[model samples]
Target: MGREFIDLFDKWATSYDAAVTGHDPQYRDVFENYDTILSEVVSNSEGNVLEFGVGTGNLSKKLLDADHHVIGIEPSKAMREAASAKYPDLTVLDGDFLSFPKLDIPIFTIVSTYAFHHLTDDEKGKAIKAFNEILPVNGKVVFADTVFESEETKQEIIDQAKDNGYNDLVYDLTTEYYPMKNTLQSLFKQNGFYVTFKQMNKFAWLIVAEKQ
Candidate 1:
């Protein structure tokens, strides 16, 4: 992400939590499903966690409440500050996933929710390799994001939106880029992780990759 992007998020930091979760049923479902997946993963692991794009500490708060130590890496200063204020005890860092300094500590699990789609395909590949370097052999990377499975699916969604009379649906979808699930799974496997994907809904996906 660039400085301009960070600035945009900084401006939205305060309202992000409610803006994302309050109005849309799909957005709320993303949160609910992510909570369940994150909880299940944390419950099965004993090691520390590093959460990328830990916006407003929504998921981090849940991990902390479960007694899991989490280090949150966020690029936007305002977002980081907001997360820090919400969970004073949690460690929140200011950096993007691709450029963040590698940590010295062992990461049992690295997770991102509703965040990874901000990256382009090449950037996502670099992120996968970076995570591979920092994690143990058995460590896992859990990613949950809004995505389309293929071009056909994306087009179907576009058609549905138009038929349903959503004026801005096509414009909105065209502006933001989301990785195809198969592309991400291929990236994970190529980087030496065993990957499993779960479709949370028509446009949401959760991928759990364990180092092989």
Candidate 2:
């Protein structure tokens, strides 16, 4: 399922930036909030940062502006192409998060947004383990994604979408990808990271984990 989704996204890459940029303002706000979260975690001396899913370079551009040396790994070829075109200087690699190329240099911080929830539970575990293996003892990982809200809230959101004329388009497309917050946190905890920061909002949660 994950591989199939990746392939589909690769096909959608050509229009992804336009599609997402025009998406509901809430979606864009998620990424903006991520930048705020990162500001709290990244220090002046923090070295190389790895972004697991550098989709279209939206987040990458912000990180680059922060003066961090950013390396991005993106699985979709089309997405990588889009990112390369936008930020030619970014080190974007075509690879899956589970099998990302191991860098000889130690990582300072690992970050991903929206993309991590696409992984199945087992894959999420493997991803956490991989991050642990690559990060130094005190390194941090910050991630955020849409999470499953209560049935009432979820239905309300769906109903709102229907009223907004997005029912047939966006709602159905995103329903399948919603994840549960506890489930994601457990995966990280099982892999030896401590969840230090967690903020749950309407339909998403942001988490910051530090290596113990």
Reference-based lDDT, residue 123, model 1: 82
User: Mind giving the per-residue lDDT tens digits that candidate 2 earns over 1-212?
Assistant: 25546766686677656555546553443334544544544432256788888888877787787788888888888888888998899999877778777676678888776677677777778888988988888788877666654556656676666666764335443545565666767877888888844554454466788888
Q: In angstroms, how far off is 56's CA in candidate 1?
A: 0.4
What is the overall TM-score of model 1 with all chains considered together?
A: 0.86
State the lDDT at 82 in candidate 1. Answer: 91
Off by over 4 Å in 1: 1-4, 24-46, 162-172
- Would you give me the overall lDDT of model 2? 0.69
TM-score (C-alpha) between model 2 and the true structure: 0.80
Q: Global lDDT of each model? A: 0.76, 0.69
lDDT for each residue of candidate 1 in 54-154, tens digit (9 for 90 to 100): 88888788888877778888998888889889889988887887877668677888888777877878888888998898888989998777777788888
